[model samples]
Target chain A: MKPIFLLRLLVIAGFIGFVEALCRIGIIDNFTMPPPSRIAADLARALASGKFNGPIRATLLNAALAFCLAVTVGITAAVVIHRLAALRTSLDPFFATYYAVPVLAFYPLLIILFGLGSAPKVIIAFMLGVVAVIVNTLNGLDRVPRVLLKSARMARMGWFATATQITLPSAAPFVLTGVKFAVAYALIGIIGSEFIMSTDGIGFEIAFAYNNFDNATMYPLIVLVMIISIIVNMLLSIWEKQLLERRGLR
Target chain B: MSLTRIEILGPILVSVALLAIWQCAYWLIGDIALRSPGQTVRFAGELLSRPTFWPHLVETAKAFVAALAIASLLGLTIGLLLGLGKTAGDVFEPMLIALYSIPKVTLYPILLLSFGLGLSAKIAFGALHGFIPVALFTMNAARNVRPIFLKTGRVMKLSRWDVVRKIVFPAALPEIFTGLRVGFSLTMIGTVLGEMFASQRGLGYLLMNAIGLHHVDVIMAVTLMLVLFAAVISFALLAIDRHLHKRF
Candidate 1:
């Protein structure tokens, strides 16, 4: 077995073991502190029942769509802001505090514009991810060495050509980090929105189970959401590494 | 002076343009559900005079402050524990990181289920949101303390407590402050969201109540207040961070 994987497994197992001990020792009640083994079993049962199928698809679709939109809008805005000092200075304050705002509080207004459908959720997810992306991408572009740009200028390259060929390539690492950050935010946005106000999604399923007091189902569903999101994050990070590595080869 | 004026005017001009567009959109849409910026701001002014306003605002403030306090206490303890202990950090860091990665609000239902629809539930949920970031950040801060700093303490023949209090703590302050900033924001999100989900009182409850009654004016007023509250708190935190940065 890979040593890192083994270590991770051991760590997780140790946690579960501790929880099991606490429950066994009557330090923690089953209702509040369900045994990890029981939760795992419930997960298996829940999966077998295929209860999460629709919600999983719904969340993934919504989050993916919103993330794509965020990426497009964010990168475009970043490039524009990078080129225009006026625009960048004007919008910097708003972007800095974007994360502080209780963005989902505006859901009621969103509902009015888009109706009580997936549209509001999409917008919420987009806003959450896009702000992070814009900030990071702008910072990344700003960090590009002036010497490189000056060299490009000496070559008599057009602004667009210089930016595309020189600036964008060097700034890829930061942009990718922003994208990864956006994905995480997008998922959080979708899940939180779903939990707060949604007709469908893993978040809805969680609220459903909670309302029913089906603790077993609820615990496992939360675990499932974590597991899926973690896997997605790992995949994204791997992709980022590969992209950067390929750039190095070039 | 001219350049400074230009810099200041840039954001103001942008905001003005955006507001104008919003007004234009209001005219075009002509939806009762949507209000003009003037209408919303006027309503917000009126809301300040309402009897229900102070109680709801106070409740939210209480929960927000209480949650941050609890989160800090718990987060610091756990962070220090895991950070100082090599074996513990190895064993528990992964779990803490995994927990942080998950949208913490998902666990809100559990908190609500246990604590019921009340202030405690809101505080607990808020603390949950804030706790992980603070803990993880603090853990990193402590774990990554420079060996040279520790060696300096040893060279001075300092006691263990003295070494940690004088050397380790100052080094970790910046990251700890970062964690607190993130924690504070999460706490705000958690508190507001918890009240929105299920609560008898607070700004979120008031906003949700407005939504239920289709009181668009009240909703707009409450939401604007919430956003402003977030902005003011964030600016305060930023100032504190800057001061600390200067000191360190």
Candidate 2:
């Protein structure tokens, strides 16, 4: 690592150590806020016992499935809508309402419709992801240069051919941006579903720990989720940077 | 009619058609789990007449406003600090990003345990949700301040404060407003989520209660209220955004 990177890491470590020291010195009660050391130990125990793997697997599977479903539906809908200008215009309000509505508020309705299993969780995740994807894909399609479309038309390219050759390539970045948003939303939605009504998952574990007043366990579980999210986001950023470089647009 | 009027009317027609379809589908479903438009509206009317509804609404609104106020103050302070120093910005950016990406729903457990199922917990959660976007955007906007503008201000012998006030502030206003808009929405969402998880009162708790009791109509009514609240807040923010964008 570069010196700057090392220095940054040290700074973070120092901050954590300072907080830990404060808790140890009775300045901050562990009951109210457990120290980093306590949380780390709890995390180690959880890992050693393999207590977290199942929950992580379930949550990740739900997120992945929901993301794929949303993207598939979103892209197809975007393409169809883009092909018909009138339909796009007419659908604007519906889309706006969908975007604006807090889909979580409909969790009760979803649970009723889909039952208290993985189905509702997946559906919730899909609901959170799909609207953003659709809107972003539409925006991306709209951004395709008029000149390029005209050229494609002049070459007598078919609709499907033009879409595949021109529209998809031009829209890929924006679609990816949508996918990034969807990934976060899917995680939130899935975790939230688990929190509200699941028998198992990271959310369930956190809730269980809270009910038991096990601050050490609760804090570490929360920290673990935060670390996973940060890692995922960093990977997405790297992927985005590579894509931007290839397009020579960043 | 003019094109603009047609544009407006087209959406309204589509919305009505969609509502009609929903009502018809609900009618076909015909269960407590599925409520028709008429039933939903009736339930909402009934809720409006109930004495508890106002207080619940007020409590949620109060929590929302309090959270927003605290978030704005703290977010602005942190944003300014990070924005003013490149070293500070670089050091903290990753941490902010990490915190932002975390599914904060999980943190409700910790927050509830520490703060209890009270207004404080909700406010803290909302602040956490709102702070990241504000800080990130403000830092970016500050960093992107045109060098020529800064140089001109410096050559004119303006103080650092003067330069920030007269040039950097206005230049960054649009981005700051965008961040505020996003932050406000997230704050509202976070506050509601917090309430849902542990609160004794508020729309979230009420909705959960209704769900537990299998009162789908009441749940629908509460959902509609939430939708309206979100719409109103967003439109208000959007108007403010546009005005600031134009002014600056």
Candidate 3:
């Protein structure tokens, strides 16, 4: 890493260490705000006891399944809609409205429909992720140069060939952007669903901890979630950068 | 007029048809779990007429507004400060991004413990949700400010305050508005989630109550109202964004 980059990392580490020290010295109470050392110890214990594994696996599975379902449905819908300009315009308002609406607000209804299980959580994540993908994919495809399509048509390229060779590739970056957003949304959606109603998940675990006032356990779980989010986000950013560089869009 | 109308009409028609199918399916099912649109509407109307409805709505609205105000002020200040200094931006950006990516709903238990299951928890939740977007967006907007403007101002001996007030603030308004719109939605989400987890009153509380009773129709009605409320707020924000974009 560059010197500045290393320096920046050190600064962050120092800041966190300072905060942890403050908590240790009782400048910040452990009851309300546990120190970093305590949280790390809790995390180690939770991991060793295998208590964290089940919830993490379940939550990740729900997020992945929902993400797949949303991307499949969203991209297909976008493709069909992009073929008809007039259809896209009329449906724009609905998409905007749906985007604004907190899909979580529909959780109660979903619970009624799918019951309090992984299925409802998956459905909620799918709802949150799908529209963003559809909207982004549509915009991306619509921006393909008209001349490119016309030229492909003149070259006797069939619709399928044109879409596969020309449209989809060009739209990949935008779709990835949508996917990145969807991943975050999926995590939130699944967690929110689990919090509201779930038998097992990290969300449920947190709720359980809260209900019992297990502050030590609760703090570590929150930190774990934050770490996971950061890692995932970092991976996505690297992926996006590589893809963009390949496309010469970086 | 011809092709365009159909193009626009096609999706609307399809959507309406889909809704009709859903309505029919619900009617056929005839279960409390599958509430027909008509039933949901009627149920919603009844719920709206209840005295408890107004208080819940008012409480949610107040929490939302308070959170938004606090988030806007704090986010703007922090965002501007970070944006102004390259070192600050580099150091804080990853931290902000990490916090933003974390499912903020996870913090509810801690917030509840600290604030004790009251409006303060809801407000803190809303602030946490709203702050990240505003700060990030403002930071980005500030960084993107043309160096030429600052350079010229410095050459003309413009003070730091004047440079920010005249050059930076105006230039950043549109971007800030973009952040505000996002922040608004997040604030709403946070308030609802916070309320759902702990509050005794609010739309989220009522919706949960309805769910527990298997009052599916009431749940649907409240959800519809929530959607409408979100739509109205977003539209209003969009108008503001447009005006600011034009002015800037």
Candidate 4:
């Protein structure tokens, strides 16, 4: 298992090196496409110079807030819909095609309604992520076997106790999986909103650089965004694994 | 899959209620840019009456369909190859996951540089959006094909094509279809994003134009068109999904 993981790392590193060499030798244009080495060096300089810290921190803070809002609102809605058959029946179809909709279309409305700055962007992120959380939450709850509920009642476990000990734990893995998705979606939403309109944050940086035709700066910012995504995904996956293991789901 | 009268009425009633709320919001906001549902209907009516709307809609549609075709073809072929071979799946799965994690939008500039701000770039961007999910789903669906079915085919001395066609494809169709559906959605998103970022034609381009001119009605109209398109496609896919489930 470890060897295979190492091999994967080696393959990626080799691919990067190959690309770097290709660009250096002019097989791939170095002007439009910066070599991986230059990008890496720029990334390190950006880090060391503390030029990116502000934007990274801002985006992270916003994404975190959006994620929390999405989870809270999503779970609340999911629980409500689950308890009300009519609402579930009415809304399920909408939820099914939610991702298909260019949710950014609604961003202009959000800006008009929610006011400017980060509020609209945060809401955009929340809007993008909330559906997945809601759907997965309901699915997790639904999979909490009816037999378990019956047994809980038979054991005279109170509603709160049963929910805490059985329902939540049983549903944790699925919910966590939803969280993994929510994080990604939320980040994507935030960046996209920023790309469309914003003064600061990583998305804004990328857009700013591109608009100025500052390819040197733009390339690194793009890498930064990718790294941020990879890091977030890795963290969430690890967290998900831990939760699944604790629940004996893995 | 058959809906009762109540179930059918449920969504319709909810939509009407939402529209009513939308109109109420319009009243409260008192903004022409943010028009009432009735006004939106009128706006759509007016726009559709014009000759310009058709071309923009067609451009978007053309790019969308072309992207889906390319993504579906490539996704399925590559997915099948990877799924049919465990060694290939194991080697590439991690890398694919990594690539998928990075939002494809980030790479749009490079695509613009490579393909230029043309139909090809938009289609390529949309194809990239669709490809990952479709391929991922197809690979998993193919890999998860029951070993017993394959063994039975082998025991019966079936050829490779026969085993795949008779045993694997049918079993994986449901999940593969799910990927295709998701791919459609992403394709829609990608095409729109490409148009918004940089393009000469399409609803996305129109929307961006409207944004610049503060033609909020047109923005709203374009959004409504996209949403309507999504709903129609989703319902059609749902019907097909049900049929496939029943037939298979």
Off by over 4 Å in 3: A1-4, A145-151, B1-22, B246-248
**Tens digits of per-residue lDDT for model 2 on B1-248?**
14676577777787689799988888787785788888888989999999978998888888889999888777776887788787888888888877887788987876776677788888898888887888888888888888998899989999988988898888898988888877887888887787778688888888878767888888888888897778777767776777777786
Residues B1-248, candidate 4: write the lDDT tens digits.
Answer: 67887678888988998898988889888785588877778898899999978999889989999999999998887788889988778878876787776666778877877787799999999999888878898899899998999889989999988887888888999989988988888888888988887678998888877765778788777788888888789778977877886786
DockQ of each: 0.57, 0.56, 0.57, 0.56
Which ten-residue region of model 1 chain B has the weakest summed lDDT? B1-10
Backbone clashes under 3 angstroms, per model: 0, 0, 2, 0
Model 3 Cα displacement at B112 (Å)?
A: 1.9
- Compute the TM-score of each model's chain A versus the native chain A and list the values: 0.87, 0.89, 0.92, 0.91
* DockQ (0 to 1) for model 2: 0.56
Q: How much is the lDDT of residue B185 in candidate 2?
A: 76
Docking class of 1: medium
In candidate 1, position A246 carries an lDDT of 80
Better of 2 and 4 by TM-score: 4
Q: Residue B49, candidate 4: how far off, in angstroms? A: 2.1
Q: Estimate the Cα RMSD of every predicted model relative to the unseen true structure.
A: 3.0, 2.5, 2.8, 2.3
How high is the lDDT of residue A242 in model 2? 86
Candidate 3 lDDT over residue span A138-182, tens digit each = 878977888889989899998889888888888898888888878
Q: Candidate 4, residues A139-239: lDDT per residue as tens digits?
A: 99998988888989999998668867877677888888788888998888888877767778888888788778787888898988898899889888888
Residue range B119-167, candidate 3, lDDT tens digits = 8889989999998999999999999999998898899899988988898
Question: Which window of 10 residues has the lowest lDDT sum in candidate 2 chain A?
Answer: A93-102
Question: By lDDT, who's the top model here?
Answer: 3
Question: Distance (Å) between predicted and true CA of A222, model 2?
Answer: 1.5
- Candidate 1, residue A193: the lDDT equals 83
